[model samples]
Target: MSDAAAYACDNVSTPVEAVQAVLARDDLTPAQKQEIAQGFSARGLEFDVSEQVCVDQG
Candidate 1:
């Protein structure tokens, strides 16, 4: 694995943070954003969507 991946794998227990980081970036497509949002919703956590819970940068 790449160094970054290796380090994250060893350190970050919650991969959702990394996924959310990617989602926040403008590089992700709308479909990707939707998928991430849905996945987060499915986790049964109370999400403050207006608080930029995941893909929302605005």
Candidate 2:
């Protein structure tokens, strides 16, 4: 991995943060995002996508 990628991997504290980082990228399509999200789901990781949970926080 590149230095930046290695640094990010080292510093990331949770699976949800890594998943959110991937989801936030503009390059991924809906299908790709869903596939990745499903993988996280299998591992019991997720973002609270509800407006009350996410909208006010950011």
Candidate 3:
């Protein structure tokens, strides 16, 4: 999935929300999840549930 799509899936939600959404589905594999997480992290897009801000926001 594209970053925009991932963001869309995770829109207005937390990293946990994105992770959960990715986890709940069967389409992506564990490697895919890790890849997604890594991609987000590398781009500084991790989510904060409490703050409602992407890591890049700071």
Best by TM-score: 2
User: How far off is residue 11 in model 1, in Å?
Assistant: 10
Q: Score each candidate by Cα lDDT.
A: 0.60, 0.66, 0.58
Q: At residue 11, what lDDT does model 1 achieve?
A: 67
- Give the per-residue lDDT of model 3 (tens digit) for 3-57: 9988877764566566657655668765676676666563445622221234775
Which pairs of residues have clashing backbones in candidate 1? none
Error of 1 at 52 (Å): 9.7
State the lDDT of candidate 1 residue by residue for 1-58, as single tens digits: 8999898667654665665675677777777777776676534332222234467679
Give each model a TM-score.
Answer: 0.35, 0.50, 0.35
Determine which window of 10 residues in candidate 2 has minimal summed lDDT. Answer: 44-53
* Weakest lDDT window of 10 consecutive positions for candidate 1: 42-51
- Report the CA-based lDDT of candidate 2 relative to the real structure: 0.66
C-alpha lDDT of residue 30 in model 2: 69
Using TM-score as the yardstick, the better of models 1 and 2 is: 2
The model with the greater lDDT, 1 or 2, is: 2
